[model samples]
Target: MARVLIVDDDKNIREFIRLVLEEEGYATVESTDGRDALRKIKEHPCDIAVVDVMMPYMDGISLTKEIRDIYNIPIIILTARGQIEDKELAYTAGTDDYLVKPFEAKELIFRIKALLRRYGTGEEEAPVRLGNVLLYQQNYSIKIGSKTVKLPLKEFELLYLLGKNPERVFTREQLIEDIWGLDFEGDNRTVDVHIKRLRERFRQLSVPARIHTVRGVGYSLEVDE
Candidate 1:
């Protein structure tokens, strides 16, 4: 059973979420503010976090940013503000999803399940061998011949998605939606920047896997044998 942490200022809301999650066979933890939530997360990480944007001690956006700095745990932000700008802010702060207030419990549960399904678990058949590159998904790291290179969270995610389906092309827009959560809205150049950084790191380590640009389409990871 997955364990979920619910962070909100309202006692009623917390109890409601706790009961629902418990019914779904998930263990629940509750925090009334972001500071407490952060401490709890550091002490013991949960499978998912549902955070309210309007907390008393520390706001959800700041908390989300802090969490992103250290952990890759999935987070969903809850807010009364239904504006696109608010959603975008949540995304920029590293929320995995966003839900406006007055949402149905069923909808929240569905979103939680969907995120877990998309990111949860699967074992690789074998060590992914692409030319001189060896990607060990089990341990979440990579090697190029003799030297091992560690990837940051976002880079690893992007590379893994591309490498998993080698030949398939994905546009920047698709990537942003798929990887960075649906609410992410920044310049498309952000994708280009990350790609350039990824390519540079691989090159520095002499890795053979290449990120191919499909003009007008997007990028694909191609293993050159």
Candidate 2:
């Protein structure tokens, strides 16, 4: 199932969209504003975002630009404004589609499916950077300067999650949930073993980023410089 982030200030609207998305078999996450949406996306990756234009603190246009800067996910603007000027602004912010409020639920679903097809959710995003180490999402590989090497599934997932949100300390519990899933029956020490393996491998490869233990906390991926 493709995960979607819904960003809207109106409670009714957000709930309505959530219902529609969930009924269609797409998993949904909600945020009241762009700031919350940003934080949510960092914690849980989403395939696309449905962003409302008029929001507190950060508007949809601004949020769209920010998302474009960091993520390769598609963005759809949901707004009450039907003005061509507003539509243009949304496009300029890198939104893939725009839908005005009072739209038919079926139309919204169709547009979403079209965009997903065009972008192909199965495709892995562009390589993400952590210091000089380039983490490739598609092939479970990492590049250090001119050298590239494939990583084991668990190791790549662990490293990718940390690298995607640099400096954010992930406790052992969060690591297991995010990378290993709720059904994980192993001890938290599993995380430590993976971290040690990552450190050793990066050292051997001279990768510019390393996973750093956070004392009482868990760990984080940081640039070596």
Candidate 3:
């Protein structure tokens, strides 16, 4: 049973969520607010966090960024406000999902389950081989010849996605949405930065696999045939 951390200033809301999650067989820890949620995670190490948007001392967006810096768990931001701006801010802060308040308990459970499944599947993704290099999806590592190398999560995902498709061109916006989540409000330069980093790494390795710029469009991965 995965443990879920519920963070909200509203006691009734926390209790309600706790009950719903427990009914679904998820063990839960409760926090009164964002600051408290941080402490709870350190003490109990939850698999995912369900965080309220507005709170005293620390808000969910700030907490989401802090959590992302420290942990790799999925986060769902809950807010009574349904403004598109709020949704954008939540995703920009690194939350994996969002739920506007007044949500059905069943929908929350479904979203939580879906996020869990997505995270779990990352470890089972098959390794991709490109020419003389191999990208190990299971562990975010790469093998070039006999040496194993590690990659930042985004870089590896971008590499894996392109490697799997070979010559398919992926536009910057497509890459951003796919890798950073559809709600990501950041500039397309985010994708360019990761692509630049990946190119630098491959160049250093002297690999035959290359990530090509599609000029006026996007990028693609290519290897010697």
Candidate 4:
């Protein structure tokens, strides 16, 4: 059974999610505030998280950013706001999916299952290997050749997506939409900077694969042969 964390200021919403998740055979933990949610996550590692976009003390976006900094757990952002800008912001903060307010419980459950599947959390495997890099995706750590490099949330996620698809191209827009959440307000340059940093880390350790730039398109990882 997957363990899930529910973070939302609204009592009813949290309870609703908890009940639905429990029905799906998932164990759940709840927090009504972002600060408390962060603490709870540390004390109890969860397979996934469902967070509200707005909250007192630390807002969902900030919490998502902070959590991504330390963990690779999948996250779904639940919000009343349905603007494109809001979705963009959530994406920039590293949310895997965005759910608008007044959403159906069944839809939420479906999204969670899809994300879990995409992340491969249902598998009972060891580290995932890409060329000379061994990615401990569940833990958000990477082993490049002889050196183990700890990645911040954003970088780890960026690399993970590219590594998962190998040579498939991902446009900046696609990346921002998929990984950052739906409400990200960042520019395309942000993607470039992160990629540059990722490349540098791989280069420093002489990793066998490179994150290749597909000019006029997006980026991808290519195993050098």
State TM-scores per candidate.
0.54, 0.54, 0.55, 0.55
What TM-score number comes out for model 1?
0.54
Candidate 2 lDDT tens digits, 103-142: 8777677667656756788434678887777888667788
Candidate scoring better on lDDT of 1 and 2: 2
Which lDDT tens digits does candidate 4 get at residues 1-225?
A: 778999999998988899999888889999988899989988999889999988999999999998889899899998998889999999999999888989878768767866786777754436767877788766678886677778897888788878878899999988876666554688888899999998898777777888888999999898777
- Please give the CA lDDT of all the candidate structures: 0.82, 0.87, 0.87, 0.85
Candidate 4 ranges beyond 4 A from true positions: 123-225
Residue 60 error for model 3, in Å?
A: 0.5
lDDT of 1 by residue, 73-143 (tens): 78899999999899999999999999988877876776786666556632233667767677765555788
Q: Candidate 2: which stretches are off by over 4 Å?
A: 122-225
Question: How much is the lDDT of residue 134 in candidate 3?
Answer: 86
- Between prediction 1 and prediction 3, which has the larger lDDT? 3
Question: In model 1, what lDDT does residue 52 have?
Answer: 94
Candidate 1: C-alpha lDDT: 0.82
Error of 3 at 203 (Å): 48
- What is the lDDT for 88 in model 4? 97
